[model samples]
Target chain A: MAQLFWDDVEIGMEIPPYKKAVTLMELNRYAGANEEYVLIHMDRDYSQKVARLPDVIVMGNLKYAYLSNMMINWIGEEGTLKRLSAQYRGMDIPGPALSTEPTMICKGKVTNKYIQDGDHCIECEVWTETNEGQVTTPGSAIAILPARS
Target chain B: MAQESLITDEVRAAIGVETVSPPELVEMKAIKDYARAINWPDPPNPLHVDEEYAKKTRFGGIIAPWCFYTTLGRSAPRQRVPLPPARVGMNGGNDYEYFLPIRPGDMITTTSKIVDIVEREGRAGKLIITTSERTFTNQNGEVVGIAHGTGLSQY
Candidate 1:
C-alpha cells in the first residue's frame, strides 16, 4: 500500500470502503479473542429466548474494531490513529438463514485537515452500513498522516 | 403526578467512583489473535502480526492494534451503580483517544470510573445512560490511551 500523505488529502475526499460479511464463526473467533463470552452473542437459543432477539447479534466492540481496521488500512504504518468514536444505534444480525443477510460496509469521508501540535492531522466521519441500507454504527476518527515534505 | 427520576441518590453517589485493575502483561499471542479475529478471511496487518516487518518500522517492534486495550484485564471486577431493573441493557457507544501504541510485554494498568449518569425519555419508556471513563497507563507511567464508554438501559 502506498503511503497517504497529509499534503495529498482533501476535506471532502472519501476513503475507500472496507467490506465484510459478519458470520457466526467470525463472531465466535472474536468472542475468544476479546474474551467476551456474552451468551447473547454466541448462543442462538439464549439470544432468542433470553434476550428476546430474532437471532444472535454482532458485538458492538467487533464493529468498533472493524472501524479501527478500516482506519488502520487507510492510514498505513506511518500514520497514527489518534482517536475513534462509534455509537451502536441498531442491531445487526448474521445470516444466510435469517430474514436478511447483511454485508457490513465500513465507509469514511475526510471532514477536516489541519496541523495540530506539530502533527498533520485529518479528521473523518466514519460509519458502518448494512446492505439493508441501515447505518447501524456511526462514528468519527482522527489520524496523523506523514507529510510529503 | 410527576414521574420519579431514575437517578437515585445511591446512583448519584456512585459517580466518579473508581476501579483500578492490577498491571497486566501484554502477550504477543493475544495481540495476534485479536488482529486475526478482526481481519478474518483476510490477513492481519503486518505491524500487528509480523515481527520482522514491524521491527523495521518506526514502532521498532510488534505493536498491538490501537483498540487492543479493550481486551486487557477483562476478569477484573469493576464498580457498578445500583439501578432499577430494565428490560434491556446494551453498549450504547465508545470513544477513544490514543497517545501511544501498545507493545509486547508492556505492563498496562487500567483505572476506570463512572463519570456521569443521565435519564431521558425514550420510545419504550425511560432510558438511563451511564458513561464511564477508563485510563490506560504503561509501566513507565506514560499514558497510552483513554476511553469513554456509554451503556444504555431501557425500561
Candidate 2:
C-alpha cells in the first residue's frame, strides 16, 4: 500500500471503505481493554430485561474506537490525525458488520489551521453505516498530512 | 415558556472545576488486547507489538491507540455532585484530540473538569448532559491527548 500524501488528496474524494464485523466476544474483549464494567454491555439478560436492547450492544467508546482506526488507517503514516469526533445516534447490535467511509472535505490551498503553520491539513467527513444501511455513527475529523514538496 | 432548566445552580458551579487523580501506569497487556479487540491487525506492521518495528517508526516505540484514554489514568468520570440514584445514565458520545499516543511503560495522569451541564427535553423526556474535558499527560509532562466526552442522565 502506498502512503497517502497531502498532494494526493482532493476535496470530496472518497477513500476506500473498511468493514468490521461485531460480536459478543469482541464486545467482551473491549470491556476488558477499556476497563469498563458496565453490566449493560456485558450482561445479556440485563441488556434485554432492563435496557431492552436487541442484545448486548456494543460499547459507545468501542464504536468510536473503530471509527478512529478507520481514520488513522486511511491517512497513512506521515499524516497526523488531529481530532476524531462521533455521536452515537442509535444502538448497534453485534452479529452485523459496520462499514466506514470518509470523504475529503478540504480543497485546494487548504485554508485550514495547519496550512497557516506551513502544514497541509486534510479534513474529512467520516461515518459508519450499519449492515442494515443505517448510519449509526456520524462524525468528522481533521488530519495534518505531509506535503509533497 | 422558558421551560424549566435542569441546569441547577449546583451544576453550573461545577463547570471548570477539576477532579484529578494520581498517575496510573499503562500496561502492555491492556494495550495489546485492545488492539486485538478492535481488530487493528498485527505483525508486518507490528507498531503495537514488535519493539524493533516500532523503533523504526516516527513514534520511536510502541504506541497504544489513543482511545486508551477512556480508562488509562482517567478516573471518577461521574459528576462530582453525583446524579440521583434513580436517574439512568448512559455514555452520550466522545470527541477526542490526539496530540500523542500512549506508549507502553508510561505513567500517565488525567485531569478532568466539568465544562458544561446542559438540560434539555428530548424524546426520553428530561435529560441532563454532563460534559467533561480530560487532559492526558505522560510522566514527562507531555500531553498525550484531550478527550471531551459527555454522559447523559435521564430523569
Q: What is the DockQ of each candidate?
A: 0.80, 0.61
Error of 1 at B9 (Å): 0.5
Best by lDDT: 1
Docking level of model 1: high
- The RMSD of every model to the true structure, in order and in angstroms, is 2.1, 4.3
Native A-B contact fraction in model 1: 0.85
Top candidate by DockQ: 1
Worst 10 residues of 1 chain B by lDDT: B72-81
What digit string (tens of lDDT, one per residue) describes model 1 on residues B1-155?
29999898998999998788899899999999998998886798888999999989999989998889779655456676788677778889999999999999999889888899999999768899999898998999999999999998888
State the DockQ, from 0 to 1, for candidate 2.
0.61
Question: Over the stretch A1-149, how does candidate 2's per-residue lDDT look in tens digits?
Answer: 57888887777677566676666666777887777888778877988887656777778888787777776677777678888887777777776323233211111122233364787888777767776667777777888888888
The candidates' interface RMSDs, in order, read: 1.0, 1.9
TM-score between candidate 2 and the true structure: 0.87
